[model samples]
Target: MANIFALITGLIFGFGLALSGMTHPEKVLGFLDVAGQWDTSLLFVLCGAVGVTVVSFRFITKLKAPVFAPIFRLPESNAIDKPLLIGSALFGTGWGISGYCPGPAVALLASPNWELWVFLPAMLLGYVLHWYLFKPQAQKSAAAAPENTKAEPPTCG
Candidate 1:
């Protein structure tokens, strides 16, 4: 049941991305090209998303449990750490260059493009490399941390 809900949610999100021209690299690039012929259409999309999130998140966080889960799991940390900064910089640089963030990139996979053929595999390779480089360090840090300081593992439920 939870899986079905997740699938439905993902389909709706993908549909929204497609409808909003988010799946088009050209459209995204146009939006990013500030000095050139700028496209402000995607700005409305971003504003709409942010507005909705700002309004909905307050109510959502107040709930004792999520609709499909026993607990309302949320991020425990709000720290602006080195890893967070580095990851943000990398993500922004990639998005600025390719004009396709992960969500829209995945959505575009339904209607495969020449760019996606390159981007998807590269994205997957990046994931593998990040895991390989960071996994051991993460494991060691987790092992060294005091039990009381350790955060509870996030669950899909």
Candidate 2:
């Protein structure tokens, strides 16, 4: 089942994050610190991830559907809009300040310390705020989706 595969993949990813020192906020902070005592280990980790993605993406694209799912859920939009730019800036700022991106933050939750507690709540608050701002627009799009599917005839009048 898709759920089982997702769980298994999530576990593996969490374990990998833990092993890669990503679970440690200090390590990530050090990586972000360019002029200070900068750590370059995370760069290698990122490169490794990119390498894997480059190879895997080729194979994944060839597949009609995922192994566990009927269809592969891919991003619908590719445009670099204002919201995307703002979101990326916000994410980068938060990551720079707390050194806890979403993936490592989730992994750190398993053995949560004070920092994790604070960061998680703030992270969740950001998500809630985003939903509050964007959910209405998303719902409107969904409501109009059926209309888009039904093609209208040429208007000559």
Candidate 3:
């Protein structure tokens, strides 16, 4: 039931992205080009997303648990750390260069653009590289930490 809900939600999100022209790299690039012939259409999309999140998050967080889960499983940490900073930098740089962030990139896979062929493989490679380089260190750190001092792993839900 949870998996079905997730699939339905993902399909809706992808459809929304496609409808908003977010799956188009050129449209995204145009929005990013502040100095050149700038496009304001995506700004409305951003604003709409922010507006919905701002309104919904307040109500959503008030719930005892998610609709499909027993527990909320929210992020415990609010601290801005080195890994967060580095990851943000990398994400921003990639988005600025390619004009396709992960959500939109995945959404575009349905249509199979030429850029998607390159971007998706590169994105997958990045995931593999990050896991290979950092997963062991994370495990070691967690193992070395005292039981009471260790934090729970972050979750999306």
Candidate 4:
């Protein structure tokens, strides 16, 4: 049931991206392009996302735990480090070049484009490398997860 809900959620998210012009590389690029016709519409989209997240987190914090999972998968780390900086830079560079973030990349895959083919393989390779190379060290040095994290109490109306 949870798996089915996840799939349905993903479908809705993908459809929303596609419908909002976010799945198009050109639209994203235009928003990123500062000089030659900068578009501001994506700003609204981003603001909407951030606003929703902030609002949702408020409600989520009131809950003892998640509905579907043992615990809500919230980030435990509060400190920013070198990897965070480097990863953000890499992600920004790639997004600037390809105009495709992970969400839009997956959403665009449904459109029958070769870009998805190439990007998906590259992304999988990155994941594989991260697992093989960094996963062990990360696991070893990992500190306690966030204090607020816990198993979900049953669903409530």
Candidate with top TM-score is 2
lDDT of 2 by residue, 1-157 (tens): 8788889999999998998888888899999999999899989888887899899999998999887767765666777999779878988998898889999888887899998889899888987897789878777766787875234321211
* Candidate 3 per-residue lDDT over residues 42-77, each given as its tens digit: 998989889999999999999999988788776656
Taking all chains together, the TM-score of candidate 1 against the true structure is 0.88
Using all chains and alpha carbons, the TM-scores for the candidates as numbered come to 0.88, 0.90, 0.87, 0.83
The weakest ten consecutive residues by lDDT in model 1 span 148-157
Q: Quick one: RMSD of model 3?
A: 3.1
Candidate 4 CA-lDDT value: 0.77
lDDT at position 153, candidate 1: 54
**Over 4 Å off, model 2:** 146-157
lDDT of each: 0.85, 0.82, 0.85, 0.77
Q: Compute the lDDT of residue 10 as modeled in candidate 1.
A: 92
Lowest summed lDDT over 10 consecutive residues: which window, candidate 3?
A: 148-157
Question: By lDDT, highest first, what's the ranking?
Answer: 3, 1, 2, 4
Better of 3 and 4 by TM-score: 3
Instruction: Note the residue pairs that clash in candidate 2.
Output: none
